[model samples]
Target chain A: LAKTTQPISMDSYEGQEVNITCSHNNIATNDYITWYQQFPSQGPRFIIQGYKTKVTNEVASLFIPADRKSSTLSLPRVSLSDTAVYYCLVDYNQGGKLIFGQGTELSVKP
Target chain B: EPEVTQTPSHQVTQMGQEVILRCVPISNHLYFYWYRQILGQKVEFLVSFYNNEISEKSEIFDDQFSVERPDGSNFTLKIRSTKLEDSAMYFCASSDEGSRNDEQFFGPGTRLTVL
Candidate 1:
């Protein structure tokens, strides 16, 4: 598993775009970049994932540079409901277990 | 719209007692997993199950921990003896395939308190 580093917390107001970056310098070729959002007392929910370049979804977007050393999760026009902890995970394609790190806690204020 | 469901929103047990946590995964999911999070801590993976057998497990899943799929829809985790350190929120998740892109739906989690 590739170790990931992210900000401990971030503050964003409603209608603003929030971008949380994760650094994984030792990412392997087979590793995939995945993001999960977790609300208080709730299980982590899948957000967006990408290997390289950009991937967009209904909820968020993921941007991974060619280097694959880092990735960013972008939430557009955030709302207070989006306040949660976001986790960035780098793992092999063969899913086994999720090794979680201290994720980035996003605070969306109205 | 399918989601994982876990029973007994919260459980309180005494030290050295055994406890079983039950989960009903999404009807079509084939892979199951168990994870725990202590208060103010990161979520930790305990084990993963597939095809009626364990695929992998973390060091945290010691001899005291076991997983079983007694029937078709239910997956269970058993702790032979409870310890104070075992107090945490246990989450059950399932995915259609054990692949990186396959999304895993997680349950509401069962809060286990060891007294």
Candidate 2:
């Protein structure tokens, strides 16, 4: 499994765009970039995932450069409800184990 | 949207006692998984079960831990003997089988407290 690195915390105001970047220098070809959002006392929810380039969904967008060494999760027009711990996971297809890091806590203030 | 449901929501047990956590995954899902998170810690995978057998398991899933799909609608995790270190929030998740994008849906989790 490839290890991932992300910010421990980030602060964003409502209606602003927040981007959290993750670095996985040793990412393998079969590895996929996935992001999950976890609220207090709730299970982590899938936000977005992408293999390469850009992928957008109703909740968020994922941007992966051609090198695939790193990727960013972008949340547009954030709301206070979006405040939660965001986890960036790599190699979702390997071993069925989703190793979670400390995760980036995004505080969206009103 | 469909959801994964777990029963009891919380459980309190004494050390060396047995405990069973129950989960009802989404009706169509074929892959099931167990994960846990200690207070203020990252979520850790315990095991994954598919097609009536275990596909993979982590080191944390020792001999004391066992899983069973006793029937069609229910999956269960049984801890033979509880320890203080076993206190954590246990989450059950499921996903559709064979899909390229198998996004696992999680339950509300059962908070296990071993006294």
Candidate 3:
């Protein structure tokens, strides 16, 4: 498991694109970067995951550079419902435990 | 989309009382996990189960805490003696392949209020 660092909070307006970045400087070769979104009083929902390069899904997109030390989660055309906490986790699936940090609180205003 | 399900969306228990949180993972999933989130705190892993046994547990899972797969369809987490600090939201999740890139689907969670 690698410790991750992310902004404590971010503010955006509806229809704006939001990008949250996470830094995992000690990421291992086998580590995978995964992003999750958590609404209030709900469990975290998986958004996107990637080992390297870029990966896109219906909800979000993940971008990883060649170094793999950091990654960004991009949510296009955000809405008020998109306001939630975004967490970045680094794990290799060996222990199968998810270690969550404080995460970045994304506030989308209408 | 088959999703994990948990019973008793909310539970109120007195300190020192025993409580069991029940969960039904996805029908075809193999790996199960339990996690907790205190008010305004990060989600913390409690334990992971596979092959009818516990594969890993965090320091928070002590002798008072236990997990069981009583049958094919149900998984459970039992706390022999609850404490005030045990008040939190517990989430159940399951992964199908349990590989490096496997996705774990999470349930709505049970909010346990220990008083």
Computed on C-alphas against the true complex, the DockQ of each candidate is 0.68, 0.57, 0.70
What docking grade applies to model 1?
medium
Runs in model 1 deviating more than 4 A are none
Error of 2 at A25 (Å): 0.6
Q: Write one digit per residue (lDDT tens) for candidate 1, span A2-98.
A: 4999999999999999999999999889888899999999899988878899999999999999999999999999999999999999865446578
CAPRI-style grade of the A/B interface in model 2: medium
Per residue, candidate 3 scores C-alpha lDDT tens digits across A13-43 of 9999999999999998899999989999898
Q: Which docking band does candidate 3 fall into? A: medium
Candidate 3: give its CA RMSD in angstroms. 1.2
Who wins the DockQ comparison?
3
TM-scores, each model vs. reference = 0.97, 0.96, 0.97
Candidate 3 stretches with Cα past 4 Å from truth are none
| Clashing residue pairs in candidate 1 (N, C-alpha, C atoms within 3 angstroms) | none
Q: In model 2, where do residues sit more than 4 Å from their true spots? A: B98-101
Tens digit of per-residue lDDT, candidate 2, span B5-98: 9987999999999999999999988999999999999999999999999988999999999999999989999999999999999999998863
Candidate 2 lDDT over A22-80, as tens digits, reads 99998878888889899988888889989999999999999999999999999999999
Cα deviation at A60, candidate 2, in Å, is: 0.6
Report the TM-score of the second chain of model 1 against its true counterpart: 0.98
